[model samples]
Structures are given as structure tokens and as C-alpha cells.
Target: MLIKPSTAIRQDYTGLAELCHSIDEPVVLTRNGEADLVVMSYEAYRRAEARVKLQARLIAADRQAGDPTALLDATSVFDRIRARIDDAEA
Candidate 1:
């Protein structure tokens, strides 16, 4: 993790932005010696967001798997999905 004082960004915004793009990781900004904000490139932020969404989905699936009553056969699941797609198309 890269840590920088809040003044660093104020003094060199372009340079800090370049650093974020080059490193593809978050830069922690400190204010008064305490953590203040996180700065990251847009692409990195998007990837992080997608990872969080995927993790949530996996957790939901795991919980559902532990409940036998929630289970549905693959064929029925696919058929329902296909029917939805067909309906949308129509």
C-alpha cells in the first residue's frame, strides 16, 4: 500500500493520478497522521467493485446450497432463464 499525506495530492494532483494509473492500486491519503481517503484508478476501482459483487453472489450461492429446499434441477433453471430471454425478445 502507498501512503501519502493529503498535501501530496494538493501539491501534485497530476503526478498522484499518474502514480495511481501506474500502480493499479489504492493510495492511502493521511490527514493529520490518520488515514483519510483512498485514491485509485477508475479501472482498478471497477475491477474491485466487480470482485465485491462476485463475492456476494458466491456467498449467496453457498448459503442456498446448504438449503436443500432451495435447490432446482439444472434443466428447469435453464428452461426458466431461456423462457425469460424468449419473452424479452418477443
Candidate 2:
């Protein structure tokens, strides 16, 4: 984890931005010696968001798999997913 004083941002916004882009990770900024905010490249934020979404989907799938009442045959599931994709494309 990269940690920087909040003053660092006010002092060198460009350098901080470059560090975020180069590291592809978040930089923690502290104020009064306490953690305050996190800064990251927009691309990194988007990737992190995507990972969270995928994890949620996986968890939901696992729960559904263990529930007999929610079970759906593989063919039906795939057909419904494909239909949704087709609709999205159209």
C-alpha cells in the first residue's frame, strides 16, 4: 500500500497522479497523521468495481446451486442467458 501525506497532493498533484497510473493501485492520503482518503487511476477503479461485481455474481450462483427449489437445467439457463445477450445486442 502506498501512503502519502495529504499535503503531498496539494504540493504535487501531477506526481501523485503519475504514481497512481504507474502503480495501478490506490494511494492512501493521510491528514493530521490519520488516514483520510484513497486515490487511484480511473482504470484501476473500474477494474476493481468489475471484480466486486463478478464476486457477487459468483456468490449468488453458489447459493442458487445449493438450493433445490432454485435449480434450473443447464440448457434452460444457457438459452435464457443467450436470449438476454441477443436482446442487449439488438
Candidate 3:
């Protein structure tokens, strides 16, 4: 969604918040016909931040370990998670 900065400044926050939630994506806030800021939901922002942190952690681990062989198989990780879920459900 394209929003003018002046409109954003003048519009009611509740309406803006509703628009952000309903869109489920970043709303482009424009200034002078140019893109300026992006408005996104708090939940979306949190999820994105979590993903970025996870990726950063993985990258750091890779740099420190210096060996791909030390990593567990993806399936093994999923299997462990499944086991934990099953145990919790039992």
C-alpha cells in the first residue's frame, strides 16, 4: 500500500493500524512521490527479527566450527522435535 507522508501524519492511528493488519505486508509510506518508510505489523516484525537472528546464529556457528561434518542431519533434527512433541502429548 502506498501512503503519502502527509496523509499518514493526518490519518487516525487506529485506521492506519487496521490497514497494516489487513494488508499483512509492509505498507510503503511515501514522501514527495518517493518511497520513504515501510510500516509493518508488530507480529510480522517480530517474526522477521527472529528469522534474522536465527540466520545470524547459524552463520556464526558455521564460522566458528569450520567443519560442515559437525552439523546434524536436517531429518535427525526434525525427528528429535517430533519425538519431543510425541512425548509431550503422551
Show model 2 residue runs off by greater than 4 Å: 74-90
lDDT of 1: 0.98
Prediction-by-prediction clash tally:
0, 0, 0
Q: Write the per-residue lDDT of candidate 1 for residues 33-80, one digit (tens) a residue.
A: 999999999999999999999999999999999999999999999999
Scored by CA lDDT, what does every candidate get? Answer: 0.98, 0.97, 0.81
Ranking the candidates on lDDT from highest down gives 1, 2, 3
TM-score of 2: 0.80
Worst ten in a row by lDDT for model 2: 65-74
Candidate 3 lDDT, tens digit per residue, 53-84? 99999999978688777777889999999999
lDDT (10s digit) by residue, model 2, range 1-90: 899999999999999999999999999999999999999999999999999999999999999989998998899999999999999999
TM-score, structure 3 vs. true: 0.59
| lDDT-better candidate, 2 vs 3 | 2
| C-alpha RMSD in Å of predicted model 3 compared with the true structure | 7.2
Best by TM-score: 1
